[model samples]
Target: MKGIPMRINVLQHTPNEGPGMIQDWSDKNGYEMFIYHPYQFGYLPTADETDMLVILGGPMSPNDDLPWIKQERELIQELLNQDKPIFGVCYGAQQIVKTMGYQVTKSPAKEVGFAPVYRRDVKFLNIPEELNVLHWHEEMFEVPEQAQLLFSSDKVENQGFILNHRVVGLQFHLEPKEDNVREIVVNDFPYIKGSVLNQTSEEILQTKISDDNKQTLYKLLDYIIEK
Candidate 1:
């Protein structure tokens, strides 16, 4: 008999900020995708029903006192309690750090476009030691206790981290598609300032993520599954 397909539950905080390349990856990788937009109307899946958990980026901070925020953190905590495989992006990554009892602070400069990062140290995701990836957040989390620091950029000390080699948190936008970028830029361009680390709208739109980064993201997903 054929085995059951793996189920990937995507917890999205915003409607526009949907899973980009992640949705494509799941369709091609034989994983069933279920998205929960608590902001609109939905309930988070039970831990037993979810094979993988993906927390997408949002505009709100993890520290926000919204009801959904608390519920989502509770769900993430439960998932972590079981050592579930998880991939968090931007605000999602910050949520992981905050859930682990750490501070996610506002960086000195907002990273509003492509930025370079040194793949400091990680055993799970095999990526180039150095590469420029997509970015669009201002807050950075301190390295959480018992979590391996995976990557870092000049503007943020904590770009990525891994807990128990299963729960991965990434502050960058490794899975953003063209539409996703356009949407965020259109809706939230006011946040982009003229800081040295900030990129202009034109520059951000012009910078096409190369196939190398796409491949690495896929490999990262595969690593999560195979783990």
Candidate 2:
């Protein structure tokens, strides 16, 4: 690991939604962390300087008319061309798929709340056949060509995918810590209506966090950092 700082660039889409569990893991592992908040801050990190890039979930679509979306998509494509380690969640995953010539459309049913994701292929992931993962997305992205399908849910077929074992696309929120979950319940409750998330904020607080899911996330982060 000499000469490599294990630096991670986090692209945050919303002001309230920042690096959650990823920040904790990075801090504990002594990895350098940089954040790009497109909402408040008007800039994004350069792909060449980033060893690992994490694109956090957002409420916007990948095909939105915003200039930043286009810029981020272009950056994703650039990173893919360079074969850099990339991890994208929710809308970020959608952006990755879009950048790779796949389409991201509205899901037949919105997947929100605690849902079970079954492993399609457990090659790199260290998780069980079925695991409970946090969900908060209305759109789902198609798996790009040549990507390995990893996880899926009853509602969405493409819950997770791997590209050349270096890039990952996750439709669910794997970085939701206790505080992040609470914040989402309090601040984004109004948008949860008519979706699979029909529980109250107090109900969400009582939901248990599976150790398997946590371990899977750690394994993923470790894999990316080691690569």
Candidate 3:
């Protein structure tokens, strides 16, 4: 590990979908954090300014014709060339897959609540066989040509993937606190359609946030940074 504190750069797409426990993790680890709202203003950190890069989830699709979206893709590519540790969630994951020359398509069914993900036998990542995580995404990415599929859920086959062991992308969320969950639930509740895969607002609201998920997120962050 480097003796100096790492400078973590976060690309936040929306106000509601900000990094929850990620901020907590950075604070606890004494890492310097700098978050930028690229959707509002297209100011992303360069590779030199970032020791680690975190891309948070959002409601927008990676295929959308937004300027910041395109910029983010280019930035991901640039960071990959420099071998920076990059972590992405949901739409952010899609962005990474898109940057890797893959398509981000709609899943057979939407996952909108706490769902279980079965871990694959990946040596680099030490995740549990089964974990109930928060999911609120409709579009999903495939495991790229040279990437390892990390987690898969019943509804979504490609729940998570890791590229070159340094770039980690997760479809399900394990970083949201209760308030962060509530914010997304309240802001995007109208889009939730009640189905076997999609949970009702009440069910999501009633389900307490798990501490294990937070710990897993912290572990994943540490793993990515140290790799």
Best-fitting candidate, scored by lDDT: 3
Candidate 3, position 57, lDDT: 91
In candidate 3, what are the lDDT values of residues 19-136, reduced to their tens digit?
A: 8999999999899999999888779888788899999998899999998888888889999998889999999899999998999998878778887898887855566778888898
Q: Which stretches of candidate 2 lie over 4 Å from their true place?
A: 1-4
**Cα-based lDDT at residue 115, candidate 2:** 80
- What is candidate 2's lDDT per residue for 155-189, written digit by digit as tens? 78989998787888899987887778888878887
Worst 10 residues of 3 by lDDT: 190-199
Q: Which model is ahead, 1 or 2, in terms of lDDT?
A: 2
lDDT of each: 0.82, 0.83, 0.87
Question: Which pairs clash in the backbone of model 3?
Answer: none
Off by over 4 Å in 1: 123-125
Cα error of candidate 2 at position 61, Å: 0.4
lDDT of residue 181 for candidate 2 = 86
TM-score of every candidate relative to the true structure: 0.93, 0.94, 0.94
